[model samples]
Target: MIKIISCILLVFASTYSFACKDPLYKDKYQITNFSGYSDVIVARIITSKHNDDEMYSPLMSFDAAVLEKIKGALTPNQVIHVSAKIEDPRAACPLYFKENSTYLLLLERQEGELQISRFSFPIESNNEHFSSYLSQVKSGINIH
Candidate 1:
């Protein structure tokens, strides 16, 4: 009887699913840590398009003009390309890059190219909150 009850409880527990909460907000220390972890730049999206090719389907790419190099060695006005996954309804954090919008991007360099993800530290270029974080980066604060 004890073994049968334990098996039934285990079966029910295995079938149960839990919903995950979205973690969209980054705290000050986390934002500051991104400056040290990835190449940080202020850039304007020159163009963006969804990849429709079957080989690269489900991806979106953006061509951006680097407005300023906050932490990285990127040259001002240089055109850089970045890519991310399309907005997934099942994803907790869906990142979308809009054309003509400016952003302060934390980019991860991969195989000689830059990429951004929903987990990447991306903030609007005009957001006032960024000033405080940028100041810390500029001051060479210890990110760890």
Candidate 2:
């Protein structure tokens, strides 16, 4: 009975830990579009599982609104660094992708191209930490 209770508690703790911190979590992923949409950068995550495919499937999309704001405060063509907490679509599926369940992104526009310079994740789940990290990333960039 004690063992059963301990296992139940463990499962509950793990589940609570896995919940996302920010409802508006955003991730930075590299994307190159020649459509003059560089001013409006978008983030699309491609699963590692689909590496062999020519096209990258977008897990989600986020407008670089925070990055835009940062740019507005800085010089033209200035690089803006920001982080967004990304959701794992595979978390719900038998369709798991890679081992790391979350990712962070750093993005900028250079020479009419939107570039994602960084993508990584934390060791554990923390929604507040994720949101704060993204906010810090947004604040670091000179969006103007």
Number of the top-ranking candidate, with lDDT as the measure: 1
Give the Å error, residue 17, model 2: 1.8
Please write out the lDDT profile of model 2 over residues 26-117, one tens digit for every residue.
Answer: 46312222232223322222333322342233222222222222222233333433322233434321112232333343334555344432
User: For all the candidates, what are their Cα RMSDs to the real structure?
Assistant: 6.8, 12.8
Q: Write down the lDDT of every candidate, Cα atoms only.
A: 0.65, 0.35
Q: In model 1, where is the ten-residue run with the lowest total lDDT?
A: 17-26
TM-score on alpha carbons, each prediction: 0.62, 0.27
Native-to-model Cα distance after best TM-score fit, residue 117 in candidate 1, in Å? 2.4
Candidate 1 wrongly placed segments (more than 4 Å): 1-29, 34-38, 51-59, 85-91, 137-144
